[model samples]
Target: MNCGCDEQRRVTVSRRRLLAAGAAGAFAGLAGSQLDTQLAFAADPAYSGDVLVLLSLRGGFDGLSAVVPAGDPAYYAARPTIAVPKAQLIGGGTFFGLHPALAPLLPYWTSGKLAAVHAVGQPAPNRSHFAAMEELERAAPGTSLRTGWLNRMAGSLGADDPFDAVAMGTARPARVLDGPAPYLGLTSIDAFTLTGDDAVKPVAATMAALYQGAPPALARTAGQLTGALARAKALRSAGYTPANGAAYPSTELGAALRDVARLIKTGAGLMTATVDSGDWDMHENLGPAQPGRRMHDQLAQLAAALAAFATDLGPDGLNRVTLVTISEFGRRVAQNGSGGLDHGYGNAMFVLGGGVRGGRVYGSWPGLTAAQLRDGDLAVTTDYRAVIGEILRARCRVGDLAPVFPGVTASSLGLVATR
Candidate 1:
């Protein structure tokens, strides 16, 4: 049942470890009643930025499959068996066409809310998934800083609350949110609660009283837990139904996105959130562009969930939010004997939101001809950090990019409008 990738195997073990740690903190008993400083609440009312959602596509995602280069004859030559036929593509120009499985998102594409940036990746290629992912989250290359880019971004924006930077969906701590900034991790809104916290047991109240006269740090941590528990309780009590008749799929991505929308709509002072989706390591039988197949089904699920998220948010909510997708790396250009691709370099990124200048592909197209390929992989013309840096400045109102991505300049792709 494993993906046969070193990182995939490591991630499974890591998730287990994170789940144990998260459970002990999020579901604390009266004996050790501590929320582990993972939950805090301080909102910078002056802070104004789009609620950035970072979706990590774990395992090497084949960007060539999602954003097909139909106009490139070499693309078909590379993968004749798995290439998305040009006629079945949708919402693309002469050079690029989205995979047919992405039909759900075509409306957003056509309406200028969704866009893709091709040939984007790390500054230099590192094929090892673990190393690449670590570097990807760290983002500050050629520096000894261990802090994650999102944490730096949050710190730069004056984020002091646990709600400010959240790692939603599975209760695992996001590496991208690693640093001094306080953040929360939860599976969903309703599930975010202290263990045995009821009127009968009153664990939360007891914990609050226990830390009443404690020192500043201890008392502050206790207070944060109580406040966050109270807020989560209120949300659970009120309950939620997707707005605008938006029906999110029963999948993890759908639920995670739904909760993200809920947080935004309820004004949770959320600055950034991170979510992960795995199972993209297609080393065999990636399949053709047809329903029930691996690639097609995965893309369809992604499209459907994203479509639901946007529909639920509507225009006003989307205007204040932006979501971007990233992966450690992409797949090789040519299909293998098993009809799959191996690890690769350059990939594609999807940016979706109200401020986005969508309906077109962005980024320099390094032709797929053998001579243009970088070691049989797509050549990276756009740095992934630069793309995000641009979004941070233009849409998120981040005045300085040096703190988050040291030595990197924000891209001038005009991918999004400044707030």
Candidate 2:
């Protein structure tokens, strides 16, 4: 028919117009380009006075070796080979001495800014490292726990945004940081990002929209991280440098700690940052006397890092940070054939900072006799939860410790400064 001419005119369309429409949709994310950034995790807020720096001493630590009970005859009697001499201690105190390895902490102790809690740990008698560590990590002693205590604590704190809680290790480790919330988990705050600049914005928006209704906690956390991509990107582009001629030791923990210092100063939310140090489980070659066997080198390295963190942060930075160190458990009262201490119960926990009452060992000491041992371990007089719980309530402004450490109660050790 003659309508072919009319049909051709009606169906005619320009390539440029079609391309423009497609490009517009992509830019608007209708074609899924507006949002494409993964919003599953990271970045919550800047530190706001209430923050904790958790330093975990992995492996079983020898509390007795760390803080010698020189005044107790049972202590010297129990370990004639590994006992520290009271005379070498920096401060003249009753019934106590510091291991030759812990010389760095002497100043903190003398200044009364360090509170040492001996015979502290969960009552879970299970010595399996995997089980015990998990138990402590969950902050739950008797029951099976899912989320980490730190996660729960953050939940209880009830911040407007959940990204305040942070763990300094890998994306996810054990106990303390598990749960649903916005928690930043970058070993390097330096390498986090949202691909592309202007082009990436549309994709980032699309990605965020895709996760519009997910409940994996990680999903919501992802949403919270969208705004942080820019900040994270900038932190990554800018490198970090230490101060006061403070050089970190060439150890994994030392590096991690240095990173933590950098993040804290950069004004990250960082309510809680955990830095773990492994290799404390000395079953065979723990030489408490020798240079490398037991405590000498390890203590020096630990002290150097702590001192450096404190100095760089200075009084103000030091005041804002609360550093607590713990191990899975303590070592045995008696030395083994391999010249090392075996797994036992009741290790010491160290609280160091400007706010700590310090300079004195808190907690009632349990004797090293067979009858006093809890299944051949030192009897636990102070629960680890009580110490940490009190700090959370007092310093962090999170009054309810029950949820963070479910079914457990806390008593204040008066470790914080009276100000």
Candidate 3:
């Protein structure tokens, strides 16, 4: 996976550590804040590309339950107890069908704004959550590069502001946004501020004066922090109301996505944003396709949040945004004795945006027959990186993807239209 790039030549800094140092003394209250998400800004304000939203479905997600292969008899045989009955599926084609739980997104799927890619995974099989996720985010399997692919993409886009790349939602660390690219992490928009910064104390003002005469590196870091705080303040002042009557659910995912919509609509120079949703590791009692069941409830929540996001953006706003879903890995082809699944190989990805060629599943489906299974799991026919690389090239205008995903070429699935 060596791309002839020198990792030593690229100077990097942890934005989190930089913030802690910049406000070391004055902002003692900073420790109490829940700063989990990160945001970085681009230097080129005129840069025109889709706002790439990456939704990481953490834990081992069961793609088989979500996107059922009803046409394949082998699929039913493998998971007879847990398989989604063909009669309950929606958005059906000759081969694939959407889980009924994903009904919220069926309109988007039918309207050519949503699509799914099956049989997608890494170059090699990795069932360990930590190792697989680390590799998934790093995205350069055989290379010495430690930077996340999103960070590389930001660097390629000439991102200089601390708000260009954002990791929005829950306090979970977004390993995908790690690298040299200047980014800011916070729980939400309103929460992004220097603690105790009021009219009386004025912590931000004090820090600005303190670093005014500091060295270039120190001063630049301070400036980025202060500048980001100012922008966040402005956004807070301008109260938001979701457009198109889109009602976001009362959940963490819903709140995170609502904020993402706010940032995009505010015309913030948001090039890429990452959000995470966990608890997909259903090892037992996965239940049935009913509302109270585990799989159904999770998918319903996911579809609701995503549907609200798209609705709030509307057609015009959505035209400039592209959202994709990925997980560390997928569940096994066969359900276990407990009626749940274990970590497996191949997975499925959902691509949603105005530019997406929707209404059908796209991928080279290696049949689910026992002979085709990779060690009792669905064999990966298309690399996940290639799926993303195609989107990067077509929608984001990234000419060369080798730096971001070494030794991988974009899939020619025509999944997205050229920007």
Candidate 4:
């Protein structure tokens, strides 16, 4: 955590901050608005050590499907078409087999940066995508909760560069980061900065004033936008490319991750950054071919971006960082007539870092027999919040899990590689 980079001056005012003013901009049309005055700027901090990178694989991903349970005849019977064969997978095993499509991640699993949780999910079996995603994002295992868990986390992080929490990929905001920490929803790194040579003092003042009368989310958006604009200009001067020989897919997800790598390496005190990948809800033909099927490509790109990121940052970076990937829920065990799988419960969560208790799958594997499926889906043996709670407690040092996840007891899986 020795955070001294080449002398980058105390940030001056700039345009990126104007566009970035909305920490909650992702929810502009969605959820309730934030207070206007919460938009005040913060001074630079002495520490930016611990970082949490959250990747939400939207669409209920298949934990059983992703990490196949080939040993059990029930598994093959459950997924006749989509079930990955034993020999084709990363490693031959009795209980597990990564989709052959996910070969990119094999090295990490072997090197000990990746850890998977089988039969893992939220407490209640929420089938609706909106409901399940909302519960997960809120970090609330129960239905009766509002405000975001990450927001509460921001509340705990105290304050830094309002840029402490960022949603790096989508133009839309994420549910987990719904609380109060100023978070920017970034699609491109270029868009993350300012436009002109100098900081637009007049325009900044005008926009800041206009947003002054607006809601708090708007005001904060204006301020953070301005701050990012400033940093973007400086970052532009750096003109960086992938330094550690980490190759991100030449896809949109790749672009998103590359920016994240740049920000982390360059001393941007980003405490939480969220990235997303979707299309996992495969109700038909979730199979693998040369170019691979939709599931294959999706998993490939996902694993590629992740592997590249870990490589780009190198071993030292991985030591200080923990990357957690989650889905809304899991997919059904039984494949449909369309050759796809339906919505189910109990998926997996992958926690990666040099410190993770790697080389093993965490959580109790509820077998895929008739008795195991919760009303026809994988029965959840582990609560997702328990995993998040452990990270917040150990890595971030934020002990109170109640505010982040209300009503439910946080059962620590201890999957994190805490130094």
For model 1, residues 270-330, the per-residue Cα lDDT tens digits are 7887777778889999999999999999999999999999999999999988999999999
Q: What is the lDDT of candidate 2?
A: 0.64
List model 2 lDDT by residue over 15-38, tens digit each: 233224331211110001110111
- For model 3, residues 310-337, the per-residue Cα lDDT tens digits are 9999999899999999999999999899
Task: Using lDDT, give the best candidate's number.
Answer: 3
What is candidate 4's lDDT per residue for 1-419, written digit by digit as tens?
A: 21222211112224454345444443221111110001111234433435677777877887775677777888878766767767777744557877777788788888777888888888778889998888788765435667777667766666446453343222336666555556655555554433244354456446556777677757766666556555665777778788778888886567667877787777655666667766677777777433557777778788888889888888888776788888888888888889888888889888887678776678888787899778988888888877877877777666677777776565567777444
Q: In terms of TM-score, how similar is model 4 to the real structure?
A: 0.82
Winner on TM-score between 3 and 4 is 3
Query: What lDDT does each candidate get?
Result: 0.80, 0.64, 0.81, 0.67
Please give the RMSD of candidate 3 to the true structure.
7.0
**Which segments of model 2 are wrong by more than 4 Å?**
1-48, 142-144, 159-171, 191-229
- lDDT of model number 1: 0.80
- Alpha carbon deviation, residue 264, candidate 3 (Å): 0.8
- Cα deviation at 224, candidate 4, in Å, is 4.1
Candidate ordering by lDDT (highest first): 3, 1, 4, 2
Alpha-carbon runs more than 4 Å astray in model 1: 1-42, 162-172
TM-score, predicted candidate 1 vs. hidden true structure: 0.90
Each prediction's RMSD over C-alphas, in Å, is 5.8, 13.4, 7.0, 7.7
